[model samples]
Target: MPTPDLMTAELTLTGRITTASNATFLGSIGEVEVVYKPIAGESPLWDFPHGTLARREVAAYMVSQVCGWDIVPRTWLRDGPFGEGMVQLWQEQDPVQTAVNLIATNQVPEKGWKQVLEGQDEDGQMVALVHEDSPALRRMAVFDMVVNNADRKGNHILAMTDGHRHGVDHGLTFHSDHKLRTVLWGWLGDPLTAEERDGIDRVTEGLNGGLGRNLADLLSVEEIESIATRCARLRLEGRFPAPSGEMPAVPWPLF
Candidate 1:
């Protein structure tokens, strides 16, 4: 059988993902399986506008592509069983590999990992948040900053079997305000590498052209401007930024 054109093929809902906060579904289009989050099913949020989450997801994908990082999977907005929504190619993450981990404070590794923070676990035992130190995750961290990702939960980072890292669930991104909540604070205060700076430059340049035009349809002018400003700021600072603002630095439940 021929492969389906994901962009235009009819999407059939196979099952509902009950664990999701919003109405999410497992869908198939020809030979491909996808995760679909319909706009009509989005739970209203005080900070974000109603029904715009799907667009934000797609916009994040576009920014990821422009940066040439491929951090976000193939995502787009299309009509589904409920209505127009965000659809993304499903990735099978390596079940055994977790990019971020919570280890006992005394058991934290001495190498190849960055300790993000230390806290007490539910049992009041000392624990530390640590993540692998690698270029893939660094690129993802930069992507999150550029998008102003407000919810970068640990589970959102998909560790692929082939060693690639993919970031998903980007609906809470591109807010005009500074809302950079995430569990990937391992690189906080570190200097940006040359490659990372180049990626930021690429995004900064693209925003004035095709990227800017495309985002205008999905985000308000202020939000688009904010993204460009973030790129510029990151490039100038050349370092990972520490968390600010009254909001928590990490997403609740972390995972």
Candidate 2:
């Protein structure tokens, strides 16, 4: 169970995420929109330990910070009705604006799967995927691969109206084994830009300093090693593309 602190105030529920695998509540503490998840009393799918949920949530925020993108939600540990649990800041986005919907609308040219998340067209349909050729997107691909994220579905990406792309649903991250599955497969075999290489180097360097110590508390040694190995491989290959492996590129259900 999480130790209660004074700053951890009770949250008031305003909505519910019925489609999620876990019981998630959309609520607010003061003026902040947040989502709450109580500890499992009966069945737990991921079977997380008492404090692992909060730790993993924090880990996601740390990774996002290191990636130079405020793409992840702010997460913290808090006392819940059931037990210790995790809470995340809820982002206000268009209910219909998702990577999947944006891509499937076909408002953009179908060069490949890369036409996803570009933007809406003049006729209010989705345009081509803009991040397909960006250095930032390439770095994100490497980050996802290192984390072994198995559920990088289109819906997981939140495309803000202000041109910011945020990714959510990171509960399945940090798997000790390789299990990466994502939809950003358009960059396979493309050479990494200079900026992309520098970002990989930055990530590798970060792992040797404070960032490494912070992750050490939440992730296992093997997981940390996986992060290092992925960075090294990307640096050596000098390319941003789909990795050659027997694993599937997409996860089931798309979310």
Candidate 3:
């Protein structure tokens, strides 16, 4: 998306992203519903250690675009009512009452927690949280690991009404080293499926050609190498790579 000027005359604040660690405003950049990061928000969180979250978000968007996966928010660098930072078009999700809800709810059954992205019920009715993990979802997990996504909580997985899973929030990615933290742990020791392996191969081959060139513009050579290394390790090991550092395997406050 083309970036708008800092002094845009038509932007309007419609909502606030209170879920994020820092303050963010939801506004329209032209006709898109975008979450804007203004300078007026609170200072960065000391524990997270992102000097500029907006920059990382934009970089992650670029990576997603090159990877041929529309898992990221439609991001762009622009100035909004808040200030200059990354802006993303908001995604809409279904509001069904389900078995595994990301957000807290009291009405859901205790045995099977109602999730935000439920699947069909026993009676063929649409339920909350979908059942059965998908190849696309697994692919997204590998991509998240490659990008060093620091935040991959359940709520971040936007389950669209059409059965598509969209991952969001890339502000904490590409830390120049192994810093992956996520919740998609379905395929811990399982072998990569054909499609999953094919995707990895595609990325590996792409890195040798146009993909590397494109990533180099936004990420360091070492960062890109780490991505390749991780991909190779997963392919060779036929399992999810284990963490070497002392950091927590999952991000804090999983929900």
Instruction: Name the candidate that leads on lDDT.
Output: 1
Candidate 2, residue 88: the lDDT equals: 80
Compose the digit string of candidate 1's lDDT tens values, residues 128-188: 9899998999999999999999999888999998889999999999998999999899988
Q: Of the candidates numbered 2 and 3, which has the greater TM-score value?
A: 2
Ordered from best to worst lDDT, the candidate numbers read: 1, 3, 2
Q: Tens digits of per-residue lDDT for model 2 on 1-255?
A: 443332466667788788877667787776777777765622344533443555666676777777665667677667665566667877777665444433434444454236423445568765444234444455567667656677787677776767566777777677666667877766777887776676667768889997799999887787788888887877787776564567676665554
Candidate 2: C-alpha lDDT: 0.66
Tens digit of lDDT per residue, candidate 3, span 1-255?
566553454668888878777778878756667677753564666444544567667767766666666778677666665567667778887777211243323344544221333345446665443222565577678778767887887677777777667787777777766678776655566677776666677777878987787667656677778778877877888766655587776666666
Error of 1 at 137 (Å): 0.3
TM-scores of all models?
Answer: 0.97, 0.78, 0.75
In candidate 3 the C-alpha lDDT for residue 67 amounts to 60
lDDT of each: 0.93, 0.66, 0.66
User: How many steric clashes does model 1 contain?
Assistant: 0
| lDDT of prediction 1 | 0.93
Best by TM-score: 1
Off by over 4 Å in 2: 1-7, 39-54, 95-98, 101-139, 243-246
Query: Considering TM-score, where higher is better, how would the candidates rank from best to worst?
Result: 1, 2, 3
Model 3 alpha-carbon miss at residue 110, Å: 16
